[model samples]
Target chain A: MTKREPFFWITVSCGIIVLAFILLPLIEMLSAPSAVMLKETLKDKDVVRSIWLSMYTALAAACISFVFGTPLAYVLARTNFHGKRLVESIIDLPIVIPHPVVGIAILSVAGKNHWLGQIMSELGVRIMGSVTGIITVLTFVGIPFYINAAKDGFEGISPRLENVARSLGAPMFSTFFRITFPLAWRSMLVGLIMCCARAISEFGAVVIVAYHPMIAPVMIYERFESYGLKYSQPVAVWLVLVCLSLFLILRILALPKKNRNHD
Target chain B: MIELHNINVRLGQFRLKNIDLNIDSNDFFVLMGPTGAGKTVLLEAIAGLVPLEYGRITIAGRDVTGTAPEKRGVSIMYQDYALFPHLTISQNISFGVRYHAKAKSESGSRFERLVRELNIGHLLKRYPETLSGGELQRAALARALMVEPQVILLDEPLSALDPGFREEIRLLLKNLHESSGMTFFMVTHDFAETLSLATTAAVMNNGIIEQAGNVQEIFQKPCSTFVADFVGMKNILPAIFNKHTSRIGSLTVEMATIPVDTGGFIAIRPEDIVISTHKPASSMCNSFYGVVSAIIDQGFSYEVHVQVEDITFKSLITKGSLIDLGIREGLVVHLSFKATAIHCF
Candidate 1:
């Protein structure tokens, strides 16, 4: 593409500023943390436990997003009901609202004083300071990624394709599972990776809800406050490497195929 | 056989009200209409995609108003083909086959046989995203027919294909309908499809069937001025059949040497209205002495507009004749056509 005008220069400048402010810190972080220190810290009992909690909670949160959010995403993608934009705006709230605010909101709905939490408590379930609280907070913050991705996936499929399938002898629900979902599965996969990454790195809401069964993020923060940057660097390095590798893999997977079947 | 009785479908902006039509088994029915005439809606209604607001749709003598699309035993192909992009051509065709049978073994074996018969046996492994428009359509047909649907509905299936590929698909569709004996209902805005493939044609306007008949019958003998004009009738006027003679209707019928049957307003095709710059001899059919109102060249033919009394009609003539006659506006000419050429409804 040819350089257009001053607008092009302005866009480039803005891009430069964003990368410098956000990515430079990550670059510096990689250079400062040695592989030796990270390897050594991997053996730490608390470090290992926090890593385990992060993986499990992220997995649980991703599963929850898939189960509950997918149908809602599909509905939002396919239909044009009243207040659809409003519903979409509401789904996007978690991504924009401060993570701490997300914690407060989740607490009002599912905390000790909430009806949902009390009902679960009656069934011998606990939320505050428990693994459930950690996963719930992670899920709450990470849901937007899954919903948005799945919605785009479903939207990419023409409704006519589903119509043709239905006309050919597939029922309503069967058409979705057999045709619509599979075509958009690659998009859903990218969404899954994003949801998992978001869940693992979730700090504000998870910190507020259940800092006890410390996921890696909370552990990093505690170590930074109590023992300073040196103790937390190893965990941060490990998290970054894991997230980046998965992101690359998902990017490759999401690209649609290209080949011609000549008649 | 399929029939629609007073079928009413109300979509967002387009509505099909009081539509009634019938098609026999092994018929190639073409729904020809202008844009937004609810042709697609009517096709979808038959395929059981869009719900019927009122009236009933009967397929093969069975009431299918309440039945779901799959159970209705209809297969529809859209203009875009709507092949599952994630699945290969063979897989896409086999999809519906496998889908209906709970056992994988039964569907797989049937799909194999279908691909072979459709002559797309080689494309069973190529995904829809990778197929050309023609390939996708063949695969889509294979898939739809694999389940042995009672009727096939095509939604402008030729519109998306490149010009070179359209004829092949048309021939393929024709042969398939012939050999398979499947009732084929197709919607197309293109007039050529109606000419080439339609055994029966319906001209839809403002969500109503303005006219319908066998393709040749409708084209040669249009029922209304709408059908006449749409079917390339360029000279339609509100002229009375001449009552001065032993005539059928009004003054528009003219002093026929041989009396025509019933007539209200006569619509003569531009091509049928012969134009001669000089007074022609008596060997002609219906001759009208007129003055050339305007002469416009249309590259291939001259669009010669002639006026007689209050009536004005267009006559198409070759440019070679144009040079010979030196035809121009306001020049007197003779227009003639056979009485049998006049179609009255």
Candidate 2:
């Protein structure tokens, strides 16, 4: 009791500081607008269109991450192959680099200067300044988070389960789908949601690469720059409201309730 | 029929080499070994989970070396039971049954029958997390058996259970073996587990079978010093082999010894030691003058540690017998054993 004099006060102060840092902006934005202002913001054609595009592209980027990143994550989690360390580091490269750098690199690669863009273009596909370009940036920025989360999920699963599945008439792929995937799916779903959210929130790379097909974050930024606080606040509030709802739902769905409660 | 011929697989830091085994169509075989002795690897190899670098695996007379495990008609139930927590008991059982040629109705009926048989009919809709360890074990067995696999592999099926409930599971395993007549190849390091259900015993060490024989013969005769030690033989003294009996050492080291050597080695279990302070006139042949170094109270019996020169041999005596003998530390005692308990590798 002698030492308890100010410890509880310090804890409350820390909590207040964190809440001010994280929740204050959201509260201000939400409280700034009336119901009419919210409805009017939702009524904006460009805002609605960008929100739809953002949702679809974010989903596409998440799907892309799932396809390519899961197996890579599994390999990282399960096997020790040559060049694995280098591959893992490269997967995390987009996370640390500046978003504008990511944007520049994507534009440089898919802007007639690289073979991949040329190949896609040759196959009657266009990437630069298109919806595909937006998805490309979203996936490039968002995948490392997905891969890292999925890898940790897979890593937490005991290898014995996969081995058991394999021995129980499952091939390598069936073992993955039946045992490994289901066991790691909750965490993978969390990863996917976070990836989708991160991709949706992306502005810099999308702005550089595919600003014409404006996503929500870029639109928000554009409104702020062109017409200042009043024009942007309503759109920002609408977008944040939707994004926050989706994020909360996904987070609830992704929790391993049985595991947490049992422990 | 399941067989392995010259199977070879190299894992990091461990290698299984030139392994050969044959199990009858419906025999329950136990594979006993120390940890990292490649028991699970061998089971996985037979089940075709992991590819073999070199070997031929024939299951039920079909060459399944490159066959997928699903196509091979085999199932493995692991120590944790590996029951899918996402599915109910019945669904878990029926997940793989469709791969079999049985009609859907018949498969469903079969799953129902297995559920009832395993005493888990009430748990058909329950998630795996809700069930007890024994219940999960039953469900896992039901799932593996529902497919009517040609062979079932059990990897340390009881190692995860509470020790108090192990015997109950062991009896359940025994019942499964007897009632269904399914071929079960269980991998366990616990040798004292009931081999009554196992038609044959295959003891693995490092990466190879040290011995494979009838349970009694394996207990009675081991092929190597490792097998002898692993099979719970406590006193395996060096002996000079002369046919079926070997003297503990030449007459100089030990006195009045007999050998049960097969090729050139002998082993004696601790339970076979006969002790007396008054020097009983038994014709068991082997006798030694040693000082009692320690007395260990095992749950079932007392392990009397006796040191004869540099060699320390542990002899097990019952608690009642411990009372009669007044066994204590630092007492000079006369120890003796029977020739039948002495085995040669």
Candidate 3:
């Protein structure tokens, strides 16, 4: 009700338009079909299985990143060595490369007939047409988020804190787990959540890596191609609903606690 | 005992070269220097936080050149306290004790003793961010002391606290040192801190030790211009010494002895120069008549700057003496000092 400036109104109107451009399509897709269609999509066994597969593979991919990415992030944050910048850029390569290009790149190394694939097959860990392939592609596309986030978290911690711990009789390994990890846990958690979200929504790479064990995005594409709008739209809505709800819950969990330090 | 044999460290633009230092057992040795003088870096080297590019460090006669910080039995408290933000006060104090097997069994009693002695018993549940600077300092001190290290390194421990709180911690540290007879190596730029707490001190400049001696000796007889300037000696004049007579500009100074035959710099401490309205019949070998140029009230005393011909000599006078002499800017006064007071370097 207070008199607003002309520029203020202009900016507000532009923001609303952009917000509507994104929200309107999602709103239309969700409301396009009847509630009964959404229920039917939810009840479909293939739909249910694909959704579960996406969640499981995404979680697995996130776990794999957490195991390896943590130490890499700590090293990146704490030490300087030859080719450090080159290593960091390579980690960020997948985030900028096209998704299908990422898929082809993974295929070169992880495909069944490739050298690494042969080694993996010898070890009884198949990479193609298996859950491992899906996870590999998902992890490849998602690691940048985890490594970069955890690196930032580690950098946020003062090296003096670790030095003090060391001076006070703490071994280097214990210092990391006791002091550095706890201090950086919040940012690392946020990174893990981002990595998981990216993995869950992956489609192009997963389709090339493992087509038979269909994740949700591939199933959506397959339905749309064969059955057209009526059948596919409802499934797309159901996927969006499931992804959105899961994203909300995970993001809430990642939110810092109230007693968190202001710094 | 802590000894550094020709320690050299190159960290970007600042380099500490050929730094040799020996701190005796149970001595509170202070390293005083200007900012960017690598005082902190030297302390870090001793604590094993920085790699020594050359030379060796030995503690208690053991050559610990390649030893890790945890095994060195030396602890350091940083300028900003560096308390672990994730840990409670109790946990932070106990962190070191709990880590070492030799100390773990006795940690509980040690923790209680430290908390009680440091007067942080009631703040056990608090985090570092919730505590004041003084509290954080005490917590950090407790953490360092809990390890019972052979040597404790303090990096500008009082620089971050308020003046009143600085006094409080200064007294607390003094008492601890006296009671425990523990060797402490502290780095500070404040001369007042050095005077009050240091048993032996070193003056450093550009990553090199300029002078090292007993605290009072270092203050009264600075060996170099850098040491004199860094120690806040205001009257460093270019003088020519001949026999026992040193000529500084137009003022002829009679000293106990001359270090050089021709050109040298004479450093006269401000407190050593006595100011009066008239020349007194005393055994002061050097006296000069001058007009007061400026008067600065320094809380405890008055800094009276006197201009005799070309040179301005600074002298510290008690407030009561200032009142009696009624010295003001442009007022004529006489300055006198004993023959032994002039330091030539």
Candidate 4:
């Protein structure tokens, strides 16, 4: 074995401490519940519905962010304009704002006093105590992650490649689809997984906006508040398991490809 | 054919100022300059890749200043090749075919011919990162040719290749230019590339074209001091001309003909000056006695620097001549050259 220095040992010790800090609570919660308790939790109709609702809403939020954020991300990556920094800061505001504030901000825009809320009422679209409110809050908080990731992806590509493509008679639109999109899609996928993960783990905003259709986290909180640790731990364990799977998928997708294959 | 009139481009602090150039159809035109001279910027402007502050660019009789790069019927190849990383070599070469109806119709035969000619048939399925530098260069060239563009702009195409690969691609570029009848506008700092491949050339400096003309004319008769220095004229001195005689430093050098201007710079190619141990009775107009200052070994030849009065002249002599004359540092030597060898601008 190679000789290890004091600095190396110190770094390894710090890394182990960090890993333990993150993984200890998760491992204890997952192992606390017995197989019978997990099976019983799975059989409960409310728990199952909450878990499914969380996954569906989070996935919907991710899809909506991808559709709307991609063009904005590309523009940010490729061009410099007046107040671009301001626009970028605005995009990131959701991440900095408290989750409850995000919920209140959405309600303020969608409630009856505001013009947009009046229009929503006229359209018979409700943003309170509904799945729409949950998705809206999730998207508001999750889009910044998607846009930042996709912008970094686009920035990594050389504008020279696009120029060469255009010089070869491919127009700008065709060049984007043919050249830019293929190179950047992996990063966008990673961003989508990250957005989904963030949306699924959300509790404060979803609880404030839509407590009636309880997502998994809200169910865990409600169970913890009403029953105790024994009732809430199983649902928390299931949510952690789902988030862990998404994290693993993101890691696998983010690995540097071996010989251009996603292996 | 390509014509650029009053082409002015400002990119941040750098600018290409008031440029006028005319390139003939079927011409291998090379732009030579130092780094940061805006040669690449000018090439990009011609391809419509950069926005020109003020200019009119015409390609094959069509004014295309406002046209997009695709509509201008031009293709550009970068030094790095810039092949799409996600694409196979074949896919990269044929990527532009789908956008042009005529090119799409003729792509099959054109693709085969380009692959065969470029000797990249085995590399069709390989990605750009997997290929060697020369391989990427051939694929990029093939892609540029596949579109059948009216003009092809190459930005220092051979600069990134090894010497052996440079020669190989240089020959390929010359052959492609001859066979395709397409206007090939290339930018390079290598005089060897310009001499071997260019039918006409221009020298640029600090974002302006210093001189543009026949390749031989530009080399022999540079219009400015910057062009002369950039083209390897090692001996440049300010001179005061009076009829047939010009005073350079403290030495009065004779000229075959009188110059029109009173004072200007004179440049002499190093290879033209002959070094001798003893002053000989010769008809050459200029001869000066000086001590050898330094002898630099230039692989193929020795550059003997001789100081006469306040001027130092560099002469390129073969090893055999060095041995024959017993030339070394601190040796007193006589340098002689005909007055016609000096180029005044």
Candidate 5:
């Protein structure tokens, strides 16, 4: 028997090109900044405040998605209704639409002169240039990632598990809490991480909606535009390192115990 | 007792119409049907998982048509076991204790007893994905039994078991029923399982119950061609019957004992037919001589297919008989069966 070859090297070359495309820039950004410069950027009050603001606001947005998106995902996974595909596509709209357009879309509904904005303003709640506005924009752009991931998680579970739980003297809510929720937690957590990552990195929507309470992305852009590349590089590196550490920690927490294997 | 009166369920393209079933208390009722026959749908309706568009369900003489599954005191064990993969065996078995507080008070000892009963004590700390198929089944059964449900619905309980493990589980299930006296409503397509385990059996076809009666009666006398064919009766010969006699395969069978005027099919079980080399002067209503077309070895018994004219009759004989008669292909043999053994439908 003859061994076939050549196509293996071709495939390996293509894979290497793709890997380099993703890794090269991240490596350079992490290494290019001097240690003193990175430390100085972390010490800057405005830079420190913006990073804290970015983390808390993104975390808030992720929590909101976790609360509301899980039920929508469960419905999509378990039930059949007319226009379900249409609903899924609409949920997915933010991912494909331009980020600035997403900001504009939120603006039209929640802007100062809009009907919802008028009601909120009458109640002394501001939508423009507020923390609520930042979180809103973050959630608007980051929801699709959360919902899609959580839906995949719910879909991977067998409906029989829920049915069996129901038959075993558990009510619908009880079964969901005891059976469905725990089984799908891993996927939901991953989705939450992605949503937070997307929210933290948001620039165009956050810039348009609430630039006064600047997030990390907008601050980086402002530093680059007003000062120069050197001013923004360290802040960018700081944001990246913080997000990378948080992502790793959350992922580790979500991992199953070492003794038990996943299904 | 559980009764489903004129139940109608429409799920996508498969519709179940006018399905009426009566399961007495403590009766091991098995619903036997081919795939896509809505057996699972019927069981789900009884358990209140699937809604019924028409008719009502009465359990223990109470109208529970609108009751939830948990409120109905019913539980279901699925074919895949459906044990929670994240929970250990002990937690999974004790899951329903919170709802039934009366059972909860005694759950400490009951939990130990159940794990001992199901032979899953050593697996208490392990996750569901780590257990084998039989272990999963036992855990699922333990979970269902822990709730102390009145009616237990099983969807092919033994279907997921290996051939060697199936008999053991069957014995275990039989013992559980004898001790617990829980009304079991099970659905299976395997006839052997139905015969060995069921006290009563219902044959469903195209979402309709063709026959439901005692298991032995249903096996011996199926009322329809569909039931007869599904119950492992191979000789279903189409025939024309007058008031006195019905002619099948160039032979006349006396119809005075059975009341049927129109033409229908005669279903004879293979095991009921007696095979011999020569014409024995026994009091059998029908006899025929045919050439042996094929002798199929069925482990415990041999299925001898004989060609009598254009009609082929299959007779089941013991391996000992196959050896004693020296039955082989192309040999002329006499086949005889009593008039009572033939079922006309």
Candidate 6:
């Protein structure tokens, strides 16, 4: 072993404090629940349904963002026009707005008095106390993460590659599918995971939009409020475990290929 | 054949103004200029990669000003090669066949021929990042040629290679052009490349085409001071022409033909001025005695700078001649040249 410097020890001490701050509460909650208590919590039908709903709604939100945000991300990466900076700022607005404010903003546009809400009502679409409302809130909060990540990925690729493809008789659409997408798909996948992880943890916006559907975070809050710490601990532990696995996968995918361990 | 008329393009703060050019089929045309002279921009405009603010472009007698790059019947290769990293060399070379029906039918035989001729057959399964610079260039050339376009544009294809690879690729390009009879438009800053490969050439400076003509004519009789300096004419001086004689500094030199303008510049090639220790009884129209001020060793030859009154004349001589004449700085020497050797513009 090499001799350590004073600065190295100081940095390690700071890193340990940060890590403990994040991991201590989760470790305590995970260890507080008995094996029998965890088994019984998994057997509960309501717990199962809420956890499944959270995962399903979050996945749906990620898919919706992927379908809609890709073209916008590519355009933002490749071209420059009037108000481009303003448009980029607007894309990031969701991250800065308060969660309840996002919920209220969506409700204002979807209420019965508004023209858009009236059209949605006539078309038999409801944005309150429904699965649709849950997905809408999740996607509203998660798409910024997806667009920013995907935009960086697209920017990493050289436009000269596309120009060469065009000179070889491939049209713009063909070049996107054949050249740009293949080179950028890994970053897009990372973006999808980031969006999904963020959506899975949302509480304030989804609770305001659709409290009855009872996703995982809302169930944990309800259990803690009605039945105190004992009932909520199991659910929180489960949600934490799910998030841990998601971030583990993200870390693995984000690593460069040579740094990844094959075994 | 390719023709560009009034080609005007504005990109950010740079602009190309009122440019016109005509390139015959089966011709190797090279564009030479200093850095930031819009040589690459002109190549991109010809390939339809950059939009023109106001211009008309025609290729093979058809107007393609509004056409897309894919429909322009031209292929361009960049200096970096720009090979698709995710694809194998085989896949990269055959990428264009899927979009053109005629190429699709003949792609197999053509692919084989290109790989064999370029000596890249063993690299078919490799990726671009693994290949050397010369191999990547050959792969890019094969990719551009796979479509059988009427014209091809190359942007400094051999610039990034070592000298041995550069010579190899240069010969390959010459042979390919000779056999295919396809028009080639290339951009380079190397005068040697132009001398060896260019049938016709043009010089650009600050987005304007300074001169365009046969390569030898442009070298021997450049139309402007910029062209003369760019082509390595070592001695260029401001002169006042009166009738058949022009006065350069304190010396008056005879001219074979007078220029249309009365007052302009005159240029002389360094090789045209001969340095002698003694005055010769030759029929040369101009002769001067000057002290040698500097002797610069230029590898294969030496440049002897002689000062004649206020004017300094440069003469290129071999090392053998340098040693035979015992030439050194501060030694007075005789400089003489024929009247026809002086070019006035």
Which candidate number maximizes DockQ? 4
Best by lDDT: 6
Candidate 3 has which clashing residue pairs, if any? none
Q: Which 10-residue window of candidate 4 chain A scores lowest in summed lDDT?
A: A254-263
Candidate 1 C-alpha lDDT tens digits along A30-74: 778787898898888998888888988998999999999999999
Ranking by lDDT: 6, 4, 3, 5, 2, 1
lDDT of 5 by residue, B169-242 (tens): 99999999988989999999999999999999999999899999999989988988889999989999998887
Candidate 2 TM-score versus the reference: 0.89
* Model 4 CAPRI rating: medium
Higher-TM-score candidate among 3 and 4? 4
Which 10-residue window of candidate 3 chain B scores lowest in summed lDDT? B255-264
lDDT of each residue in A3-65, candidate 2, tens digit only: 666889999999999989898887988899888988988888999998889999999999999
Task: Write candidate 3's Cα lDDT for B194-267 as tens digits.
Answer: 99999999999898999988999888788888888878788999898888888888888888876765888999
Give me the overall lDDT of model 1. 0.82
For each candidate, C-alpha RMSD in Å? 3.8, 3.6, 2.6, 1.9, 2.3, 2.5
Compose the digit string of candidate 6's lDDT tens values, residues B1-345.
899999999998999989999999989999999989999999999989999999999999999999999999899999999999988899999998999999899888989998989999988988887889999999999999999989999999878999999999999999999988889999999888999999999999999999998999999999999999899899999999997899998889998888898999999999999999999789898999999999999999999999999999999999999999999999999999988999999
Q: DockQ score of candidate 3?
A: 0.58
lDDT (CA) for every model shown? 0.82, 0.82, 0.89, 0.92, 0.89, 0.93
How does each model score on TM-score? Answer: 0.88, 0.89, 0.94, 0.96, 0.95, 0.95
For candidate 2, give the lDDT of residue A178. Answer: 77
Tens-digit lDDT track for model 4 on B193-224?
Answer: 99999999999989999999999998988888
Measured against the true two-chain complex, the DockQ scores of the candidates, in the order shown, are: 0.51, 0.41, 0.58, 0.65, 0.61, 0.54
Q: Residue A148 in model 2: shift from native, Å?
A: 2.8
Best by TM-score: 4
lDDT of 5 by residue, A147-250 (tens): 99999999999988888888878999999988889888999999999999999989988888888898889999999999988888899998988999999999
Ranking by DockQ: 4, 5, 3, 6, 1, 2
